[model samples]
Target: MTPYLNLVGRDGIVVLIGAIDMVPRFHSGNLLMRRRSLSASMIGGIVETQELLDFCAHHGILPECELIAMADINEGFGRMERNDAKYRFVIDMATLERK
Candidate 1:
């Protein structure tokens, strides 16, 4: 979140986030001033979609991500705020069970 300040401060960069629950603060004026939008989107169950996962497997496509335990969600959110996390957040229950 802090990293976004530089881009949104005066660079007119759109801040696209899926969630803001972990972000501590924000300046709406700064976003509006640059004709930029802080957009939040709901990517409904894309990871759970079997078709998509199969497509990825078929094409050998996978995101560069780190898998963390569900217990580490708080830490995950912290990393997210710092932009340290790449793509993956929490590990699914099925994946956890296998381990």
Candidate 2:
């Protein structure tokens, strides 16, 4: 998670949600994969979708270029809802480039 946060803070690397599973079921013979969770939160503000889009554009980053990966869970559902509803602040790393 620290690595992900640091990467997001960097100048070139871009991070975005790629995939999501609403209901995941493993087969009897399937093996469970290990994963780590990394998420950040903001306290206030009604972040608009257009503001996020414009921010990404100003930073030379495309939201479509990034990918988010998630599994089937309540947290995942919440994230999907937040993203689809465009309720969080988005930071574009591409804007940190040298002028």
Candidate 3:
């Protein structure tokens, strides 16, 4: 989380989603100097999650993503680092059975 502080642009916000057990430690200067903010949100309960999933399914809504084989995970990381991959990467676990 500390590493992410330096990554955001000035006046940027880092929103943490879901549970984080580890106590985060970072310098106040990191936020003060850049006008950054650290915020969090709960994803919601299982029932609410299920309802959202059902709504999307009913509406035929889909997320934009790229499906990659497990073997190409390193390449996927590289793409992400280079900002080449524009969408989320979903690993096709079936590829693991190939070799």
Candidate 4:
């Protein structure tokens, strides 16, 4: 199996797979950038922002932002690896944000 890495941004931690290409989009007069091209293994389980941050810090991976967004097109269906319970949660980065 290929090792997975977390995508970190100013908005938050992005739980996705593959190379993430961030693009600026205009939505209803609001300018926003969405992280795209995320695969299943990239975020097949629950992830905490602190865990991601600590991982990055230990690995020397610098984050460009503090905002995070998760994209699971399958809603986490059929993405289990050997029926592991670790893949049954939706991690919300907002909860881990520093006030």
Q: How much is 37 displaced in model 2, in angstroms?
A: 1.1
Q: How much does each candidate deviate from the true structure in C-alpha RMSD?
A: 8.4, 17.4, 3.8, 16.4
Residue 27's lDDT in candidate 1: 71
lDDT by residue (tens digit), candidate 3, 1-99: 679998876787989898889648899999999999988988889999899999999999999999999889999999987868877899998899753
By summed lDDT, which 10 consecutive residues of candidate 3 come out lowest? Answer: 90-99
List, residue by residue over 5-75, the lDDT tens digit for candidate 4.
Answer: 12322233324454456523323212124332322343423456678877999999974432223444244
CA lDDT for candidate 2:
0.40
Task: Kindly list the per-residue Cα lDDT of model 1 for residues 1-99, writing each as its tens digit.
Answer: 445755543444554456556645777766666666555555447566777789899999988777777677788899877867766575655545443
Clashes of 3: 0
Kindly report which residue stretches of model 3 are placed more than 4 angstroms away from their true locations once superposed.
8-13, 18-39
Worst 10 residues of 1 by lDDT: 8-17
In candidate 4, how many Å is residue 7 off? 21
Clashes of each: 0, 6, 0, 12
Residue-wise C-alpha lDDT for candidate 2, range 7-76, written one tens digit per residue = 2321322233434443233332222122322323342344666777678889998543333232333454
Candidate lDDT (C-alpha), each: 0.65, 0.40, 0.89, 0.40
Error of 2 at 81 (Å): 23
Question: Model 1 Cα RMSD, Å?
Answer: 8.4
